[model samples]
Target: MPSRSLTDPPRIAFAGTPEFAARALEALIGFDCDIPLVLTQPDRPAGRGMKLTPSPVKACALAHGLTVDQPDTLKTPELRAPLVEAAPDLLVVVAYGMLLPRAVLDIPRLGCINIHASLLPRWRGAAPIQRAIEAGDARTGITLMQMDIGLDTGPMLAEHVVDITDIDTTATLHDRLAEAGARLLIDTLPDLLAGRVTPRAQPDHGACYAAKIGKTEAALDFRRSASELGRRLRAFDPFPGGLMSVDGTPIKLWRAEVLAEPGAPGLISRVDDQGVVIGCGAGSLCITELQKAGGRRLPVAEFLRGHALAAGQQAQLPG
Candidate 1:
């Protein structure tokens, strides 16, 4: 281990990717500790032009003048050697896409701890934020846990819950969780380093996986209940956005509200300055915000000003 006096704050090595992880890294920068290194996913092609983009965590680490490593796999000895050489007292992970093998996990004196986006044993997988909103969960939060071999089946250190509001989309919920998690991590670290906090094994009950959201799931099905479809529109915001075919032209639904009106599913029941009321199997949905293919997102009143979608028309599911 790197030479250090007991009075010094713990030496930390952080590994993470994405904006959520970057937020936690930002919090750590303000702490009274030595951050030996930061490990983030490698840059990848993105956007309409497909230009190479560095991950949010990598960019943040660089801005803070911290050493950064973007290895393809940490399991290999050559790659793992540098981490062991750093001799971090603790390893902090947040949304790191790749799993750390047992060899690497054993390197840190205090072992690896993760700031997961969901309560332990619930929504434990790749896409907790999106999964919670998609599942219509009333609430979700962050969990600080001791990492192990199993997927998020680790012992819990701390947890903080946040309520899910009606207006909350995936984008909104994600920001809340990120901030809440950052605060929780900072508060828990001191206790953790002093051996005051005890790790509790997570119960086997209430386990569910939050699988990665697929592009295919974007296609909206009017056959489902309006309430469920409305939730989906909020869940998939700024992602594979909720999709529907209007008179054979593809349109994206951004925000919607359920209505009590009943009519044939998929058929347009009403079109006014208010919104587009589309029928569902159970009830109806008022699509207040929408966007046509190759057009800007607009309120229903503005969308109807140019392109026309009237009653008797239908929004069809893409095949």
Candidate 2:
């Protein structure tokens, strides 16, 4: 742990939810800094029973015996009072899933800082990790910025990039970026406290918003090139996984490899222990892992044992 000899460690109020945010919070705790309060989204219905479940951040905070608040809306004056009461010198937001109105941003003495998943001025909106991977970018990383009212328009304090491997899935990339962001935050906090690092304005020219990934976007379209579908397969893995329909049944694709071949789109060109190679518009995709709706995820050979998928069978995918 880096030792600081300031008059006092700045009071920090963290706002976030999900695993990514939890990682940041954990890093802050490990630094032995003062965390007065944590704000996370309210627990909501999840999974089969649709029962309300606390976010991972909330659970982690409680386990650490830290104070936590779950406010549905921060736009109102009444709801914003608690944040003021916390009297945080700095506000750090990460994957909070809610927009911060100007009032909340102005509450902290040092202003609010955000841990964004992408290199800002690039994928500026939500779902940056998924969008970067889906676009098949060679690299993506984390950015620490001073928050502004506009969406992720904050000036950047620091950034660190990581290469995107061919096999890197959304889940894998998300974890790596989160860890990287946490380290960057720790390294930059001293400069922020000393008022040494000036936040630089982001270039407006290359700004692009990463729209939230939709459930329907997970369905793989065979009419598209194998490389395109392959990117989607990697981008949506572990959540809203890529899918294709065969005989009106939905098959979730978890792992796949692109191959050079030509045949009718959606046609099963080959079937082997590795997987069923399905033809695409330009090439083919060998699906290694898959799952049927209401069925367990299985290897290609195991899935083939229960469900008959032979060569020459036509598969339909959503557009």
Query: In candidate 2, what are the lDDT values of residues 137-235, reduced to their tens digit?
Result: 999899999999999998999999989999999999998999999999999998888899988999868889899988999877798999999999889
Clashing pairs in 2: none
TM for every model, in the order presented, reads 0.97, 0.96
CA-only RMSD, every prediction: 1.2, 3.0
Ten contiguous residues minimizing lDDT sum, candidate 1: 1-10
Tell me the spans in candidate 1 whose CA falls farther than 4 Å from its real position. none
lDDT of 1 by residue, 133-227 (tens): 88889999999999999899989999999989988999999999999999999999999998999999998799999998999999999999998
What TM-score would candidate 1 get against the native? 0.97
**Which pairs clash in model 1?**
none
| Model 2 stretches with alpha carbons more than 4 Å out | 1-6
